[model samples]
Target chain A: MLSKAVQKYCVDTLCIFAVFLFTTNVLAHGGATIENDRCVFRSQGYSIHFTAYQPSFSRTKELCRVVNSLSETIIVLDFVDEALRKLPVDLILKKQKDDQLYADYMLVDERIYPAGTMQLPMKKIEQGSYRLYVNIQELAHQHEVAENVHQIAGFFEFTVTDGAKEKDQSFLARSTWLFYLLALGIFIYLMALKYRS
Target chain B: MLNANVIKKLVLSFVLLTISTVLYAHGERNQEPFLRMKTLHWYDVEWSVKNEGTLKVNEEMTMKGRVHFFSRWPQVISKPDTVFLSVGTPGPVFIRKFSYLNEVPMIQSTGVETGKSYDFEVILKARLPGRHHVHPMFNVESAGGLVGPGIWVNIEGNADDFVYGVETRTGQTIENLGTYATANVYKWHAIWAAIAVLWLLWWIRRPLLIQRYLLVKDGQWSTLITLTDKKLAATMIIGIIGLLIYANGVTKEEYRYTIPLQGGKAEVDAVLNPDEGKVYVKNKKAEYYLPGRSVIIDAEITNNHNLPIQLGEFTSANLRFINHHVPAAVAALDEDYPDELVADSTLVVDDLRPIMPGETRRLHIDATDAAWEVERLSSLLNDPDSSYGALLFFYDSNGKRFISEIYGQILPTFVD
Candidate 1:
């Protein structure tokens, strides 16, 4: 039989551990984060504002990193750095098939765009884990200083799912387990109170 | 005496703390790329300080540029229906004296449309003594700040020497805006803080949380508040009302000449009509040679002007490819212009003969430079559109210039 103090300690520890787990789950991600109320793709010294839309499905709704429908999607890449507008950039979209990546769509815009905006439209993309790669060609003078200078490149991963499945696995679905843990903690705390009285 | 382990740990901690301080610097780079890229495109930006990029405290500098609202505004962010033109600095390192959009004062938020360009000028006075990076920025109503290219500004002199004086409409001279009313602000804050602390202590002097919870659980929570507590709460509220009335009367008597902060938007028309000179260019075919890092453009050029003209420069996406053979073209490049954006190798023309007036001739021009690959323009050959556009400048012997737009499909050639 356990003493009242030990029981109370176990319950307290359980509640703290549950909160820690919930916080970590909310903060964990591969890439892409919310900044100033908008989704941004960030890498070392480079950033591209990423926004997607499915005009055929949801005309006005804007998407960040995830698309519910497998319909036609238009992705806009905004160059955050002025220098990026002077470099040639290539966008390649690939999906995983049997542990190997295959190209789904590609756009090679190898010109300096004074306007600093690029739009990529992909039609009827399949549902899977897709990786979008941004390849920025290094300047010619950069190579003169070093014989071998790697090209600057970065990528972000996004997922495509059916609308129903996305809604089914929404916040309530994920938080069900958390709610159970919270209820258990409260019950234990109440029993401790009853015993003290 | 401290042991070796304690001393070593202390040194290691000091080093770590020094390194951590660097992480808080350069927050401009931390902004997400989308806000910077999709919201506004700044071009033809010129930052000029009064004295070669160095200024004494209270000295002024100018930042002038054109801002283009990107045509394809991101759908995720709200439309830029309202925006304020402002300068981005590390806080009040510099005080903005005046800001104008298309020659109209931009004192408040105004609506802006997409696919339009506006000229802007911001005059700033140095306030602090340090090297700082400043950028022209626009704060959209829903979206955050969209910053432009940053330039380093050197401010020399002691920060204490800076002062901003203003003469009000009442002919009263205020010495410094920074220190004005600061004492009064502190006094009011201190008075409020003392009262708040007293109220907190009065409540916290009794049992809190667990005891209160027990009383609530036992259905005796109503008995927790007594007549004395109600009377004390009423007295505190009455005291706060009295203090507010007294402060208002004292402020009205002390500062009678104060004016409300200015509010209202200025109207400025942003319309431009560029002159397209009497030189016509027909892009016959364009090819990019992978090995040579060159783009060869074969075009039919027709000069409508009376004087014989030569191809002098080709500018695309703000990169100037100058023809060295044309002395006038080389002279046009300003000394302050960025060297990297100017190609080292000039535009190579197959024929040196000038095109006569009313004569149309097909000539091959090679824009060969390592910059083509460096700038990633060579990738356009593989673009889905496979099209390119550029401005061609023609010059006569007298240094007279004519401009024509050239655009056509471009093909890539892997072989030399």
Candidate 2:
């Protein structure tokens, strides 16, 4: 039989472990995701196909399909740095007819509509650098069909200086696999500790 | 002396570190200044009983504390579009009565910036009594993300039977949560506070230590008296009283409560031109489920004017019209539209062609091979009054606008 002190120590450790697990459950909130990387941004003026994924030697046509479908997909974009976002800039979509297709203009300024692919043509914007932001408002309702209303939001880095080369769209791709892997590893370790104790 | 000073320094550092660690571990307190300042300061809260002396379960109104953002300092750098106003519930724990941000209905997701004061108020109906902390939360779309600070409010009961109705100042009855009652609840708290103070005082003043005396006996039966041991007794008595008083004060301050609502309402006229001519209306109802996600819409179209209206565009929210003018595209029993932007759910339109005068059509649209999931009910707080309902814009032969309202709930469902 263990001594009283040892048994007391074990009980204390178990209690602490239980509290930690309970708290972890509460703090681990859900998040949003974008399934693919290759996307197309189209408006009346231009339809540009941009690939944000690595071309693997392995056959991954299914992966490519996932990337292609993300063109019109809305994402929840958050500003990482406050100081960078405070810069005075505007995202202007210059109206141009690519292949002679007329585009309908939405009257709201600074608002990007993801109703259809390609941003509406921006007109008469002040010269500056800006990051484009797009988001869809997800509504709440009860019917089962209302579940797929994920609002597609997009962000693009643009500059308005004369003769400014449009910033590479590749700048938007981010690798969060490391963070996910770290979180998963920690989660597994915690689960193992919990089960063992 | 050097050693003693070193020891004192070590003890002081240890105490400071303990306090700092406690404060730092409390993440909820430091998140956002707005959240810290604008907690619903609930005081003098009361719940009145019904005719049978049993508490009225469904008819309780919670007047949350009036909350206002700090009007000065550290100006909110982002514009109104960056921030969002939100309430803290573990889930949709309470049916929101009427919530106003800065005295205006919080209809839009875009929120108020910093340095601008706002009063938020919500009369909540009685909900399930899980100890939930109600707090103010802000979401910045791109810049300065979520700032959430919370306060605790304990509730105890089941939530299913809760019902809320509103009675406007004009006596117009609209279903709403009950009003604020402060006096009754605070009375109980005040009584408890006084009792605690008394108990603390009584314990301290109850003669903690007995005085002793050592004396030489002058005679066998004669009582002998000598110098009393007052030094240790004095210190013990004073220390105990001081500790008790300090503890009582600390306890009173620890349970300090403050809950305020910082919101308001706005009444603005429509900026867009209203279509006054032909009232082309479509009242369509639809249900969406995640398994092979489908939109089953029960549709009805009505032409109120003498002239025939052609609905070339049958749109729901932001989804556009496809083959709406196609004559051969018959009124489908179940027609599915491509939702490329947001997959999994399909947009169902009743008829692609125009309806005749006073004609009603029913159509069902379903989308297969789409990956769909059930959305949370909390998003409804964004558009509470259903003012931004589904619209069907029709046109006359001359291209004048005819707007119709589609009435139905957009529900979230699960597949697995």
List TM-score per model, in order.
0.52, 0.26
Model 1 CA lDDT for position A23? 44
Clash total of candidate 2: 60
Q: Please give, for residues B1-416, the per-residue lDDT of candidate 1 as tens digits.
A: 99644564575556444433222224434443334334566655777852236888999888988776765576667897878999888889999989989888888777777756789999999999898878888888777776765667889999999999888788988899889889999999999999999989988999999999999999999978988889999999999999999999999999886777867655666636243447888989988754455678999998877888999988664456888899988877666555545666678889979899888999898886544533445455544556666667789878987766676777765333
True contacts kept of 2: 0.00
Residue-wise C-alpha lDDT for candidate 2, range B1-416, written one tens digit per residue: 56633554565556444433212222332233222222212111122221112223444443332222222212233443444555556776656656655466655554443323344555555476665554444445553433232335555555655656666565767453433234535765776677668557755554443321222232322222212334545665786688668766765685354344545433322123344434634435544432223334465566666555655434331223333353322232113222221222224344555555666555454322121111111122223322113344566555555555444554433221
| CA deviation > 4 Å runs, candidate 2 | A1-197, B1-267, B270-285, B289-291, B310-350, B365-389, B407-416
TM-score of 2: 0.26
Q: What DockQ does candidate 2 score?
A: 0.04
Candidate 1: residue pairs that collide: A49-B33, A49-B34, A88-B376, A110-B379, A110-B380, A139-B374, A140-B374
lDDT of model 1 at position B253: 94
